[model samples]
Target: MASSQEFVQYAADQSSGAGRITYRKMFGEYGMYCDGKIFALVCDDQFFIKITNAGKRLAPGLTETPPYEGAKPYFLIEDLDDRDFLTEFITATCSELPMPKPRNKRKSNDTVPKRRHQNDF
Candidate 1:
């Protein structure tokens, strides 16, 4: 099931203190980012933050669960009511995650070469 828009908006708002909170729809779910680095995911209306040593230390005792199939376990944050905790936790989590690498841009003239067949000779 896809995550609800309300849930996604709420999650983003809750973590807004972390700075530049945004989200993108992915495979029927949502990947949440803070300052361009993904830190969490909202899947099926559940909140899951990437598990890092810093995050683990900050949110001790949080359950571990995969946000989606075939994925590593993340910190399952059940308590979303506390804005203060959410902001602090998200901030620490973003700090733990490395910034996204720049993507190589393709030139307008870039194109695949035509395959030459034996008949062409």
Candidate 2:
């Protein structure tokens, strides 16, 4: 398994041209989040972009493996040296995703009205 620091470095290097990519340590692996949304993950020193129908078609040879046991499948980016292909894949994935909705800033308690107990029937 790749160390979190190493994975972060790898993600940073791979996403040099991409704007403001951030790496967060998650479940012993590293999740690469672009603009506050997850776009990729790093495991065993390999970068895997989130799989989509277009990405699957573009890189049919790439394996769709679960990041962890019993997890959903993600596109395993086998060729780290292929920058052009990686870039295209990233672009395509980003384009296909709908614009992220703004997260509600209100606290859960504040959002939910307080319940009052009434006499039992």
Candidate 3:
């Protein structure tokens, strides 16, 4: 099942204190980004934060679960109401993660040439 928009908004609002929190639709779910770095995912109406060493140190008690099938376990945050904890944990997780690399864009002039059949050649 896909994640609800309400839940995604709630999660984003909860983490607003951390930084510039934003989310984008990805693979039928939501990927939450803080300050341009994706740090969490809202999948199947559940929030899964990226598991990091800093996060472990901050919230060792938090449970871990995979956001989806065949994926690494993330910190399965249950206490969504705790804004302070969310902010702190989100901040720490972002700190441990490397900055996102800039996306490579194709030049305006770049175009794929059409394939020609042997008969045409």
Candidate 4:
């Protein structure tokens, strides 16, 4: 799996427009987020955008497969060597996504009660 930093850099280079693109490690792979919604994923050094109704219509030939075992549908950019097609796919996927919401700042430990399973009732 590629490092999150490496994945983000690659996504940044592939992306266009003024919109910000971010990446985070997810399910042992890299997930690309535009605004806040996940638009794409990187696995085995390949990019695959989330399947959208619009994208399905635009690129009907694209394959919808899980990036890994027991994963959701993702549109794999079969021709990774084709930069033009990759860019177009990314742009279309990002356009359909809404801006991401800010993540909560609370710490995991802070939210957990000190007592273990106190409310058994």
Give the per-residue lDDT digits (tens) of candidate 1, residues 8-109: 999888889889999999989999999999999899999999998888888789999988889999999898889999888888888878999999988565
Note each model's CA RMSD in angstroms: 2.6, 4.6, 2.5, 5.7
Over 10-120, each residue of candidate 3 has an lDDT whose tens digit, in order, gives 999999999999999999999999999999999999999999999999988888999999989999988899999999999999999999999999766458776899999
* Model 2 misplaced regions, further than 4 Å: 106-121
- Ten consecutive residues with minimal summed lDDT in candidate 1? 106-115
Better of 2 and 3 by TM-score: 3
Candidate 2, residues 48-106: lDDT per residue as tens digits?
78888878778888888887677789887767666677667777776676656888887
lDDT for residue 121 in candidate 2, whole number 0-100: 29
- Candidate 2: deviation at residue 54, Å? 1.9
Winner on TM-score (2 vs 4): 2
lDDT of each: 0.90, 0.74, 0.94, 0.72
| Model 1 alpha-carbon drift over 4 Å, by segment | 110-121
User: Between which residue pairs do clashes occur in model 2?
Assistant: none
User: TM-score-based ranking, best first?
Assistant: 3, 1, 2, 4
Give stretches of model 3 more than 4 Å off: 110-121
The most accurate candidate by TM-score is 3
Instruction: Name the better of 2 and 3 by lDDT.
Output: 3
User: Candidates sorted by lDDT, descending order?
Assistant: 3, 1, 2, 4
- Per-residue lDDT of model 4, residues 4-31, tens digit only: 5664576556654424677778867787
